[model samples]
Target chain A: MTQVIDVYDPSDPRLDDFRDLNSIDRRPDLPSGKGLVIAEGVLVVQRMLASRFEPRGFLGTDRRLGELSDDLERTEAPFYRASAEVMADVIGFHLNRGVLAAAPRPPELSISQVIEGARTIAVLEGVNDHENLGSVFRNAAGLGVDTVVFGLGCADPLYRRAVRVSMGHALLVPYAWANSWPGDIELLRDNGFRVLAMTPNPEAQTLATAMEGLARDRVAILVGAEGPGLHARTMRASDVRVRIPMARGTDSLNVATAAALAFYERARR
Target chain B: MTQVIDVYDPSDPRLDDFRDLNSIDRRPDLPSGKGLVIAEGVLVVQRMLASRFEPRGFLGTDRRLGELSDDLERTEAPFYRASAEVMADVIGFHLNRGVLAAAPRPPELSISQVIEGARTIAVLEGVNDHENLGSVFRNAAGLGVDTVVFGLGCADPLYRRAVRVSMGHALLVPYAWANSWPGDIELLRDNGFRVLAMTPNPEAQTLATAMEGLARDRVAILVGAEGPGLHARTMRASDVRVRIPMARGTDSLNVATAAALAFYERARR
Candidate 1:
């Protein structure tokens, strides 16, 4: 069982991981800086416990500690219980979610390792928004996509906002950054995965029709940034091009939502 | 053509509609207060021009004014052009979108009017988050959903953040609030619409199988708040229960994204 430590001091050194969250320069989750993986709220902290990224410690109010008591029993990480006022003073802002867990980012899994037994995967390109990146992972997990492969220009899924938006699926879902751009796509094909690139082009086959034919085969759904869509070369490399039938005069759906549709279609079959 | 007025003073009374955007009490777009509809960025501004919520005036940088020149040709509204610094001072923060359009809230549309000639519509309940509400509008517009009906406990779709997030589709698309709660769902059924309520229930039919059978009929996709989902009475009122097939150990997708998948499936057929 995890040890519960009562912490009264707002300036305790042991609470450094949870300190000064809103400080522009000192925020611990900065990728180029502290690079800590932060899991906020009781539910997300629970998810963090179940994920591969093991929490080093926790800082939260007594109510949150009680809520997380069951999940905390299985882990050895110490829970540093603090008063709400002291917690606010330590973290530089009032955190309404009430609990936070900090973890060091583990070494990334290789693309091949993540996709080893995966039947369906989402490959993203230029999805640079942190929230969008998080939502994609959430969707991928919810829609039975086994893995996510980042092609190029995607945002860090482990970013604090992305992790929170993903509801901690960013920690749970197995994902890997592609070492090669469109070149790695060929590797997917070599592994017997048929790549379907999603586009808004009217001439492309609809998602339902395209996904139906590929239901028996291993599939990789390729999505691009909202405006530009998949790069021409990336589309050319795919086995099929699929479009979601859109209403006339409306812009393309948000990147994550678009990807969700593709993932759903794939799962439907 | 709309007249372009160069404003050098940040404190000018004419720019009151665009003042102190970050102030909690003074924010002009609050539904409880001014109830004004705001569109941010050049693209959203163009959408606002095409929408029913006609802009009374615009505040923007010269570059955005240049970008919107073609769209502004038909409008009688004034374009108050200002420098970025002056805009930052007036709005109380730097707005990277570079442009904003403010419109007075038009009178609400009736449920019958919104659902007329609609083959696919989304019914929302208790989805009060502005960004999620906005994304639903964007998704509904993109995926060929003809209209939206608010069942109960929904936020104001005309809120500024929702308008911006929806790419101003909240203004362009037709929506109506329920005069009655679950009682209003009968109106949809009375109109020969098959209402499918979205749920996380494992026993429910998958979205694809459910939507495939109803492709020829008018359908209303009902979604509720993220955590609670549709009320039990609302679900009992629905024609059928439909669920997205999720991967093992994952929670539900974001409410907007789930609704989009249902919309996409309906459109695909």
Candidate 2:
């Protein structure tokens, strides 16, 4: 069982992992410097306890400590109980969630490792928005996408806001970073995955039609950022170019929403 | 046609409609107070111009003015051309979108007016988040949801953030507020809609199966707030309870994402 220690002073050195989270998260050398994955609130903290990430420490109010007691039993990490005021002072803002857990970054899984036995995957390119990145992970988890592969210019999924927005699914879902551009597309193809690149081109095949044909095949759904869609090179590398049949005059859906549609179509058994 | 008037001063009375947007929007008596709908960025501004919400005035830099020149030709609103600095001073922040449009909220459409000939509509209950409300509009417009009906506890869709997040679709799409929540659902059924309430219940019919069966009928998708889901009374009144078939262990997708899946499934033909 985890130990609960009362802490009054906001400047306690032992609570450094959970201090000035707003500033620390925005620092230029993030995920490389301290690289701590912070999970906030009762739900996310419980999810962190269940994830592969081992907690380094936890800080929260007494009520949160009680709420997290069952999940805390699985970890040896100490829970530093503090007043809500002290938490606000340390984190540089009032977090309504009341409880927070900090975990150090674990080694990332390779593309090969994450894609193993995965029948459906999402590959992202230039999806640099953190909220969208989180939503993609959340959608992937809910809609049966087995893995995610980041191609280029994608935001860090472990960013505090991303993780919180994802409701902690970023910790649960398996994802990997692609070292090569379209070259990685070949690796997925070699592994028996038919890659479908999403686009707004009206001439392209509709998502429903494409997904129906590939329902029996291992599939990879490729998505890009909202405005400037998939790079032509990446589009050319895919096995089939697909488009969501959209209403007239509207250009495209949000990147994450588009990805969710693709995932839904793939999983619509 | 829009007439450009250069104003170097940030305190011009003509620009009052665009002042301190962030603070004014949060005021308790807002929408009902100033009752102005603000549209930011070129695309959204253009959308506002095309929409029924006529632009009262425009505050923008020269670049945005030039970009909106063609669209502004139809409007008689004065374009208050200002430097980026002056624009920032007036609006209380630096808007990278460089342009802003303010329009008076027109009289809201009624349930009968908005759903006059709708084939697919989204009914939202307790969806109070502005961002999610906006995403719903964007997804609805893209996926052929003809109209939206607000049941209860939904945030104002014309709120500034909602308009921006919806890519101005909140302005473009026809939406109405239901004075009687689950009662208004009867009006939809009277108008030939088959109400489908979305739930995470494993025993509920899958969205694909439900939607496929109702493909020939008018469909109304009911979604509640993220956690509480549809109220019991609302669920009992619906024609069918449908669920997106999710991966095991995951509970739900974002509210807007769930709505989008329903819309996509309905429009999958």
Candidate 3:
């Protein structure tokens, strides 16, 4: 059973892992900093406990402790119980969710490791926004995408905001950063994955048509940043180009939204 | 041609419509308050110009003025050109978009007005989050949804954040608040529309199957809030309850994303 330690001092050294969360220089989640993966809220905390990112400790109110008492039985990590006031003073904000869990980020998976046994995967380029990255993971997890491979310019998926926005699916989804931009395209091909790049070009085949033809194949969907879509070299390297059939006079959909449509279309059967 | 007045002072009374934008109580876009509509960035401002929310005035840097000069020819609203520093003082933050447009709230359109010639519409319930509401409008605009009808517990679509997040489609896409609750669902049926409610129930028919049958009919895709979805009474009123095919152990998709899938499926033909 996990030990419960009641903490009254807002400045206790033991709470350092959960402190100054919004501080730009001191936030523990920064990859260059402590690299801690922080999970906020009850649902996300529960998800963190289930993910590979094992919890180092927990800081939450007594009410939250009782709520999580059943799940806490599985972890040996200590729980620091504090009043909401003390927690607000320690973490630099009043958290409505009433609970938090901090975990050290585990080693990242390789492209080959994440794609093993995967039938559908999402390859992202320049999705630098943490929220967008989080949404993509949530969509991928819910829509049957087995893995995620990051191309160039993607943001860190383990960032605290990303994890929180992903409803903690960022911790559960298997993902990897590609060492070689377009070169990794050949690696996926070697593994029998057909790469389809998502574009807004009206001349490109619609997503429905592209996805329908590849229903029997191991498919990889490549999505770029919202405005400056896939780089020319990356576009040329893909096996096929696909477009979402959009209404006239509108720009492309949000990158995450576009990815969700592709994932849904691929999984429709 | 629109008048361009060079202003060096940040406290000018003429710029009051664009002042203290981040102040909760003083924000000009508050419905019960100023009831003003605000559009940020050059793209959204240009969209506001083309929308029905006639601009009362604009406050932006000289660079944005040059970018918008061609679009300004259609309106007589004065553009208050100031330095970035002065504009920042007036707006309480340094807006990277470098431009802002303020317009008085126009009269509300009735359900009859928005649905007159519409073939596909989205009906929202308890979607009070401004960003989600905005995203629904953005997705609807891009997916051929002609109108939007609000059921209950919805936030003001004209809220500044909603307009910005919607890419100013809140101003372009016509929407109306239903004077009745699910009662207006009958109004839609009377006008030859089939209502489909998005739910996460496995027992519900999949979106593609439901949409395939409704392709030849006028459709109204009904979506509820994320957690506590459509009320039981509201669900009963819907013509069909449809769900997105999701992987096990996952919850429903975001309200806006689910709406997008329905809209996309309906327009896929």
Candidate 4:
């Protein structure tokens, strides 16, 4: 069971991991990243506990602590109970979520390991927005996309906002960054996966028609950033180019929403 | 042609409509609301010009003036051109989008007016988040959802953030609020529309199966807030309860994304 520690001091050294988090979360690539994954809210903390992430410690109001008591039983981490005022002073701002859990990021899963026995995966390129990345994971998990593969210019899925926005699906859904982007497209192909690139080209096959044809085969749905879609090279490398069949004269949908459509089509089977 | 008035004063009264917009936009429901709609950036300003909303005036830098000259040719409103610094001072922050257009809220469109000749429409209930509402508009425009109806507990779609987030689609796409909640759903039914409510209930027919059966019918996709979906009464009033086939153990998709999936399925024709 987790140890309960009463913390009154806002500047306590033990609370350093959760201190002034907005700036820290903004710069995960910084030298002093602390390499920690933070989960906010009682529900997300519970998801962290159920996932492979091991919470190093927790700081939250008594209310949230009580809500998470059942989930905390399996962890040996200390639960630092603090008043909301003290917690806000420590974290540099008020958090409405009432609870926070910090866990060190484990070594990333290898593409081979994450894709093992996976039937449907989402491959993202230049999807650098954290909210979109988080939404992709949420959509993926909700629509049965088995894995998420990041190619180029993708933000850290473990970034604080990403994890929070994903409702902790970022921690639960297995993902891996590509060592070689467009080249790795072949790796998926070699693994018996048909890489379907998402495009806005009217001539491209609609998601419905494409997914229906590939229903019996393993599929990798590739989506790029909203404005500048899949790179020319990336599109050429894909097995099929698929579109959402947008209305005439309308711009493309948000990247995450578009990805959800692709995932829903794949899951419709 | 728009008359270009060069303004150098930051405290000028002409700029009052664009003053402290962040705070004003935060509480559009406040009694002090100026009863005006704001369009930011070059693209949104253009959309407002093309939309039913008529800009009373424009505030922009000379650079944006040059960009919008073509669109401004259609309007006689004065373009208050100012330097970026003066523009920032008037707006109480640096205006990155480089342009603003303020339009008085016109009379609300009637349900019959918006749903005229519509094949697909989105009826929202309890979706109070401005971003979600904006996304629904953008998705609706992109995926051919012809009109939007607000049933109950929805936020003001003309709030500045909603206008900006929708990429001005809030101005382009037609929407009407339900003066009488679930009762107003009948307005759609009387117009030969099949109302399909989006639910997470596993027993509900999947979007594919439901949409496929109603291909020849005008469809109204009904969505509620993320957590507390369509009220039991609203669901009972719906012609058909439809669900996106979500993966096991996952929650519902974001309200806008789910709406997008329904729109995509309906537009896949």
User: Over all chains combined, what TM-score does candidate 1 have?
Assistant: 0.95
Residue-level lDDT of model 3, residues A1-269, one tens digit each, is 78999999999999988888775224534565645888998899999989898998999999999999999999999999999999999989899999989887677789999999999999999999999999999999899999999999999898888998889899888999999998999999999999999999889999999988998999999999999999999999999999999898799788989999999999996
**DockQ measured for candidate 3:** 0.88
Q: When superposed on Cα atoms, how far off is each prediction in RMSD?
A: 2.3, 1.6, 1.7, 2.0
Off by over 4 Å in 4: A26-35, B26-35
In model 1, which runs have C-alpha deviations exceeding 4 angstroms? A23-33, B23-32
- Report lDDT (Cα) of residue A13, candidate 4: 92
Which lDDT tens digits does candidate 2 get at residues A1-269? 89999999999899888889885565445556745899999998988888888898999999999888888889999999999999998888998999999888899899999999999999999999889999999999988988999998999898998998888999998999998998999999999999999999988999888988987999999998999999999999999999999998899999999999999888885
Model 1 / residue A11 / CA error / Å: 0.5
Scored against the true structure, residue A146 in model 4 reaches a CA lDDT of 87
- The TM-scores, one per candidate, come to 0.95, 0.97, 0.97, 0.96
Q: Quote the RMSD, in angstroms, for model 2.
A: 1.6
By the DockQ metric, which is better: model 1 or model 3? 3
| Deviation of model 4 at B243, angstroms | 1.0
Q: What pairs collide in candidate 4? A: none
Give Cα distance to truth, residue A239, candidate 1, Å: 2.6
**What would the per-residue lDDT of candidate 1 be over residues A1-269, giving only the tens digit for each residue?**
88999999998999988877764224534565645789999889999999999999999989999999889998888999999899999988889999999888788999899999999999999999989999998998888888999998998888888899999999988999999889999999999999999998999998888988988999999999998999999999999999988899986899999888888878876
Worst 10-residue lDDT window for candidate 3 chain A reads A23-32
- lDDT at A1, model 2: 85
